[model samples]
Target: MTMSQQANDTSRNPGWTSTALSQLSSVVRGASPRPAGDPKYFNGDFIPWLTVAALTNIPESKTIVFETAGKLTEAGAQFSRTLTPGTVIIANSGATLGVAKILGIRCCANDGIAALLDLCSDVDARYIVYQINSQTDRLRTVVATGNGQPNLNTGLIGAIEIDLPCKDEQSAIADALTDADALIDSLEQLLAKKRQIKQGAMQELLTGKRRLPGFDGAWSFEELRNLVQTPVTDGPHTTPVFVDSGVPFLSVNNLVGNRIDLTDLRFITREDDQIFAKKCKPQRGDVLLGKAASVGKVAIVEEDFDFNIWSPIALIRAGSSVVSKFLYYQLQSRSVLTQIAVLTNSSSQGNIGMGDIEKLQITVPCVDEQSAIAQVLSDMDADIAAVDDRLTKARAMKQAMAQVLLTGRVRLV
Candidate 1:
């Protein structure tokens, strides 16, 4: 019977066959030039060099990489392994082990990377990459259960088992997944652009450079103390004994983006929460600032929820002079951030004292304009957030699709 007929045989579960990667391609480890950072090897233009970072640092959907940080000289190229365009490479060592990326340019890889070359006609390179990506955990497990240094050498990589289909089906599966990846990449790019636009808008709106219509108020530079209803205070100075469940305890780590993140939240007893609440209770319209460790990070508490923060957080209540949302944005302004950075003491841990936080300068406009400016920026934030949600869902969908498609459980042909 023909190979295609065999692939279509019902007895073989519609042509899906299990085989080792060694049967389909040549798996080889890359090389690194000696005496790291030598100018003779690194500062030349013979070829673009690939490092594990080049693959591991990119976003999940960014499977194709166009460039590298360093280039290799003719001497360096002699020491490194040269990879052509469209070649598939995987990081073979360190924490990023098994991470796969496709080269979009002619380059050479360092010893930390392994390239899959000379793939057979029945296999699609992208299909193999998707398969590798899906089994990243398995690849890491291979290193974890091994004898030598934690590394995924060529032998281990080649010995990996793959569920293979016929050539046509492999290409079809790869094409469908590639299209999904493209959608994800586009969404990621759009989200990045939206963030950049919001940042630019912040630069102009928060400063006096751009003014909203129907407002012609002179902006004034005021100390943070003058604009707050209460003296800035912090959470408990001492860490409390954490309970299995009760009031959520937070720290500088909870300040994610412009909002508080309660994921992996620790808990303190209700008795402890009541005690901390008496000294510093975060209410709606209050601003939370990271005063230690993460130093300039800030977030606004938008809900009237019962959660207590650690000593690393500073609580601020806005007075009638400024809007709370406005204060939140102003604290994140470039000028204010610069001031905070300058005053941050870095003896043991980066700490911005309450006194220093109160004394920092901020540019503020009339209350009416402050509200209007804050509204405009908030709308932009909402837009970016919506796109971000879509991007996240798209990524999850791609993973699900890969699980089914790569396993030949769902046939695209």
Candidate 2:
């Protein structure tokens, strides 16, 4: 079958919308420079240098400080950085391992960073970086050569054979992909604003500064235990329990940015799901509180899907004293995670016990007010989710286009 057939679209990337895998050029592991704090090493000259940390920062612009992570005193370029504009820098190994970035400015990179350059005219630096992003999973699969620290050497990088296109077509494909990315970025920014707006709304409403319309009520401070049913539960942790197909199971990874991704889900069997249903099973309208590692992500299950949790999650169902939506908004508020982290029994990663959340005191407004506030926040969420859904479809479209165009199985005008 042609590559276009494989990607399921023919007209998207006409000139074989191109992407480069990777090539191991000159790999440098990085040097223990005499510390940035050392006066001898840090002469305080602004020489642009790249590191794995620099690559991790997506929007890093200014060179606040630089001498590069590794020192090459007069060996070849000395303090003079060697990166040219539009070069692809790959983090072969480091704390921020495997991240790739496009350099706007030329700078000397640490030995821990691998530089891929000198591509043919058909390839663009930024385009190559984008392609490598798609190839990172494959790169990771083949990382087996480092002494103890596996790395992407020149050999491994060069062998990453991706389909190619003419230079202009490559640029066009990159531009289109970048357009989708920029839309996603804008949606993300809007999501951030929504969070900030909701935070303000919460403080105002909960503090009685801004009362919702028709809110006539008094609140009695009560134990959280009195307001919520059994608030704790564990997940199915036994190995091989993961069925090839069954019910969607939620672990700590299921929670991201205070939201549960219903897509890309796993399934549990009818029998096992029934067993865990009482303890960790998630019902519609119930909130899932992260109890370990990535703590304080609160998501209310939207539908009745067969889902069980691990020990790191606390399933909370607020009783009549509160609305689940209100409580979920409260948990998702800005300071809630910080507060929860402090209360958790986190030896390595933070973890909040069901008891930790139960004893907490929150100034909850009357039910009607809580419902109104929940509605406002939920509206903002719906707006964001709409944008997210659009972006997801757009990206899927692009993926289909890539498959078809890059394989020369389809043509585009």
Candidate 3:
């Protein structure tokens, strides 16, 4: 059976009832003021203005949305539909179609969104929000308006069916999901805090501003080219034909945040790999920097692999003076990133060249201090990774809970 059909079957519990959404609430398509994007229509502070983009900040299980990106003047508000707090809003057009949020304050929304107001007392708004969000894929498949570009109308949203439990069960399901949301939010906040601490540590430790205890030596400044054993080099200038499975061919997209991600790597023939490796063969200790689209992202090669990089990725192998991990962190420092931004800005295609890479300068300390600083930062990274893993698991569990609890397959009350 299809997902929606399975959902319908699951709702046939002892006390649950299946109902069309129109029976529980009224759906109103939002409007936009004439002369769109005019400064006169906004910022006059008559009512908060909402667009599909602003709904992104609303937490998944949240039921109220107070602030918005723009405010409508009285004239603008006259041309728009004013939705009161507690109204459920859904984006009905464009890429944001099926995205939904609850209005936390009285607001006016643009034409791209629809508001569900005057909800019946039997329905818990949060439960409805979760139900609608979980069925976004199904909703998109059943759109009643537009051809190539899908759009949702009040008729489509209102006619959509939902399985409902009694009021208490609805509240119980919402509370359970809300508790799960709280856990996810807590993990997210903790991750942000850890990242902030790591940034501060990088700012202090990478620079000689905050020296490690028991070590006090003046740091030296050197051009990046002098610190590396090989002359700073990039992969082949021309693109090679991709094969089904052979040696991995990496590009700027493969460099994912401080590491080379081989998950979606394209492969070239071994003969092509041999040709590219002749120029810049990446080893375990070399530092890889993206010079094109994802400019300045640095990753240290952690394992031995017979992989070749694209022309946009520059490879740097540290010499005797600097450690590989230290060089990686140095490239990630704000100072180097700022310089990279300046260099890329000067170029037409927003890419830095090998020449640009060689001209870049970095501050370095003695080998011992470099290792110590890298260790401190690496430990922090490990801690953050652990929390991130937990957050991922929590989100998965919440989704599973929603599928069962919201469907009445597992009764909570």
Candidate 4:
């Protein structure tokens, strides 16, 4: 039998029943007290007031919300309804739509949320949250769309139909998914710690504060133009004609921290590329610095692709004195970034001009020292990237597990 048919058959058995949410719980729509910003309506010693932002602190597998950001006055509590612990809450409006959390403490929520109280004895709160989260896209689609803001009322949320299994089966599925969530959470935390270590390394190594072992040369400060073989230049001032595919045309958005991200790249015809190349054609090993909206973001060209850059990107070809990789890190240093910020703030267009970019000061070491420093930083980057890859795979695995367990395709009980 098909999975759906099997689920239906199980529901027909004595212990299981497929039903709408309204049949299992009483849906209570939340409310906001009058004079929302008034001191009289807030900061009371009574109940905790919950906002949609507070739900974010709750873990994915968790069913309880212990604390919230805001508190309500006694008068405010009279206008709002308080939900007991274990009550399921969903953010029903705004960008946080479909986000679900369970109440661990008694609190009153604003109009942006809906609370499900008095859940049936046979139902598990965590399983219900998982089921609702799995169908988040569908719930968002059902919300009214138009000039008015899309929102969900208690009636609409209560009408959602779910395929129910026996209480034992529900608990088993919830446990499996909860374990998977824990693995993902662990990986995410490790990745965050690795990134923090990388930032600290950059702060020390990029500047001359902490010297690499065996390298003890005094660094030299020079204008960015002096460090490059060619004059500091940018791409075409005017927009070029874009085509389906020919040569990749990059902008400030393509520069992602010391690396070029080809994703979401625009294209230009070969003819247009040839014309734009006259202004600033990026060669392999050249450092690209964003001079526009995202000022001072740097990326080293690792590939020798026949590509051109947009006007907002400044291309720098390191001379014999400095290596491209070393210059890229130097540009990202706090000292250089502070200068860029000052220049950017003084400009009317909120961008650093080519003239200002050429005059920006940077410190550089000997070529051999530069290469050694680059290698050390590069190794740290690889470590962080490895952790990030593992985090991605863990999340993907959890998503696949959810699909099977929530659908009853692979029964655990």
Q: Give the winner by TM-score.
A: 1
| Candidate 3 C-alpha lDDT tens digits along 1-413 | 45477556855687777676788888888999888877778777888999877777666645468799889998889999999888888888766678777777898999899988789988999888888888787677765444677888888888776778888999899899889988998998999999999999999999989999878988988999899998999999998999999998899899886878889989999999888888988999999999988899888888887788999899998999999999999999999999999999999999999888988889998999999999999999999999999999999999999988977778988
The regions of model 1 sitting more than 4 angstroms off are 1-12, 144-149, 346-348
TM-score of model 2 relative to the true fold? 0.71
**2 or 4, greater by TM-score:** 4
Residue 32, model 3, lDDT: 91
Expressed as tens digits, the lDDT of each residue in 113-153 for candidate 2 is: 76666655557555565566655655665653446777766
Model 2: lDDT of residue 96: 44
Ranking by lDDT: 1, 3, 4, 2
* Candidate 4 residue runs with Cα over 4 Å from true position: 1-18, 43-47, 56-66, 73-78
- 97, model 4: CA deviation in Å? 0.6
Residue-pair clashes, model 2: 16
TM-score: which is higher, 3 or 4? Answer: 3
What RMSD does each model have against the real structure?
3.9, 6.2, 2.4, 3.4
lDDT of 1 by residue, 111-144 (tens): 9999889888778888888878887887787543
Q: Decide which is better by lDDT, 1 or 2.
A: 1
Cα shift from native, residue 367, model 4 (Å): 3.1
Judged by whole-model lDDT over C-alpha atoms, candidate 1 comes out at 0.87
All candidates' TM-scores? 0.93, 0.71, 0.92, 0.89
On lDDT, who's better, 2 or 3?
3
lDDT of residue 285 for candidate 1 = 94
